[model samples]
Target: MSEVKNRIAVLRAEHKISQQALADAISVSRKTISTIETGRFTPSVTIALKLAIFFNVTVEEIFSLN
Candidate 1:
């Protein structure tokens, strides 16, 4: 189905934040970040909103469906 997920990875790298750092910032486990980046997990809207707020970008910029 060619689903798309986790553009947070790219943005995270651009900001030079480690997975653990982001996980801490977002109050999730580091493995959760890994799962999310790998598309094995989907975050709630609140998490998505937190991520967008952390990155200073829109939620749509962090996620998309293909």
Candidate 2:
């Protein structure tokens, strides 16, 4: 299977939002956001959509298959 890559850290930095802050906004744990940013976890579709909506970007913009 192809690996999923993400630009979450970059986006978060650009938005000046901490991992915990983003996690709170999305109703997820900070570790969940951390793992996703570190490529240790892949978020569910619901989480992905929540993130995309919060960041004002599409899911494809945050994550991609590589």
What Cα-based lDDT does every candidate model obtain?
Answer: 0.90, 0.95
Clashing pairs in 2: none
- Candidate 2 lDDT over residue span 1-66, tens digit each: 899999999999999999999999999999999999988999999999999999999999999999
RMSD in Å for model 2: 0.6
Model 2 residue 47 lDDT score = 94
Residue 24 Cα positional deviation in candidate 1, in Å, after optimal superposition: 0.5
Per-residue error at 53 for model 2, in Å? Answer: 0.1
TM-scores for all candidates?
0.91, 0.96
**Tens digits of per-residue lDDT for model 1, 19-64:** 9999999999999889889998888899899999999999999999
As a TM-score, model 1 comes out at: 0.91
